[model samples]
Target: MDIIKNIKEKGDNMIYILDTANINDIKKAMDIYPLSGVTTNPSIISKENRDFLDILKDIKGVIGKETMLHVQTLSTTCEGIVEEAHYIRDNVEGELYIKVPVIAEGIKAIKQLKKEGFKITATAVITANQALMAAVAGADFVAPYVNRIDNISGSGVNVVNDILNQFELYNLDTKVLAASFKNVQQIADVSNLGVDSITVPLELLDKSIEHPLTDWSVQQFTSDWKKTYKTDKIIIK
Candidate 1:
């Protein structure tokens, strides 16, 4: 029942997060799995065609106060980014982590937000150098897009690995929140490296814990038990 203790015993305490803003998907994922947070981007938000603040509040209502909600800033300027960060904090309930990109203005905004005592998560990072810059800027978390990196002739998992090594070498406080995964294997491989967390789509979330052989074995056990007991249900006094 102690999840943290079990994760420590397994030698990996990787946090799981759902990477979509769909309220139904978030509710379903949390109902079926142990999730630490939910992450969103401009692209994900654009899909809903709904009011941004209402969607955020609805997501918070589903995930509750215990889970972290990550919302990205759409601004490309430091001032605009800061404004959006403040608006999100003022409107959204519970703990919020504002996601800023690793671009020029974004870095400046991150530095400013950090100085102002905000929970900053640097996102859309394609290279290890970008992640390093986010760390140097004092971000609470850095997200490396795994599948997107591979699409551009680079290894996404490798980028995450390199960042982890750099964070360890320099003793940075930033945690890598790997994102943009197309398959379950990408998450499994990165979890082995002991990355801090990963945000995956709902479709691939349950796949990591399922196997066809396991289902077959369970069916066989049920059949054998029914034959011996003459009933599928357990009898109790």
Candidate 2:
């Protein structure tokens, strides 16, 4: 179905998955050229030791123009969440996606945010039903914690599968963002399953570039190139 072409060319049914723990990391990820957006939670922001607005501004500056930047809301009440959503949207540039929990208050805020033309993501979700509810609430993204679910009982992949099936059946626009990835296998599995996108950590992104055969072939090519082309200096035109 030319999935990559459809994703990058048409921009239909495609999502950008980013792994960012801090502003600098988010900037680095965006600098990679293929990153579509950055995702963060309270825990990730807390580790930066910078004020929330300052960190957000830094991220926006790095990931400018049409990139999606998600900021998680900590408030439990719908009113509080809505207020935070407005604050984030007002203060941030480009598209600001508010990350809310999958609880009732979050659903309420999501509905209102959608009505107000604000992008929203329902995060910390672990079940297919939660994905369903988030879609029904008009969430732009539904983030399922794959590794965290596996860490507790090892049914994470199944949850993702169910959510994908449900999304297909309902023709929902809420993209399933497989998150909390622990290894390369999980990334490959989710990508193969056609989950909309997966938010991996920095370590896993590095691991994705590692393959024993690929490494060996690259080393062989470099050695052969050095042996064949002896000169290291370039001639002036």
Candidate 3:
């Protein structure tokens, strides 16, 4: 299967968030490869200063077809939320996943939307119980704000683990997507625990491939290459 299809097939296992804070940043991030999909919020969209449809179109263009592009709903009413979800699905050409908060209204919207065959993601979840509620509401993905939970107390990672454990116990299909990642350690921690997916910031995603030793090793390799090539040139082709 293609990369996008593979990523989506992994579902709860692999999730990459778009944290460019704008459309242009999204484009740059996708250029790096292995970008499964993007998660966007109202705050991130506000920085773009463009209509939601315009921004969605630009994101779909850069991410291409089969990429799961998540957009949060602004309305609190179930009807309004469904309306917005449908609007986004109709307007965007790629795989559009509607992000509903884990509030009561959002849960109502999620159940209704799921019945309508619309993909729904439960966002802003802070606890294991909230994640359970999202799953019971028929959410395709339950996102736990890891960093935010840690900020309040230092148990965000534990919360994510608890959710994962519960889901396995009940055999719920809803995937636990760890969100609000603050650093590479958080990603490593969650990934190590075997959580379904992690929606990380762009900077942290880039940092995941780097470490002090890796950077130093690369610098040393470059220096050695320069010195070796000074006397004679070696070309592959």
The best candidate by TM-score is 1
Clashes of 3: 3
What ranking emerges by TM-score with the best candidate at the front?
1, 2, 3
What TM-score fits each model?
A: 0.93, 0.89, 0.88
Worst 10 residues of 1 by lDDT: 1-10
| Runs of candidate 3 exceeding 4 Å displacement | 1-13, 229-237
Q: Report residue 232 deviation for candidate 2 (angstroms).
A: 6.1
Candidate 2 deviant stretches above 4 angstroms: 1-14, 232-237
Q: By lDDT, highest first, what's the ranking?
A: 1, 3, 2
* Candidate 2 RMSD computed on C-alpha atoms after optimal superposition onto the true structure: 3.7
TM-score of structure candidate 3: 0.88
lDDT of each: 0.90, 0.80, 0.81
TM-score of 2: 0.89
Each candidate's clash count: 0, 0, 3
Candidate 3 lDDT over 41-106, as tens digits, reads 898888888787888888878888788888999999999999999888887887888999988899
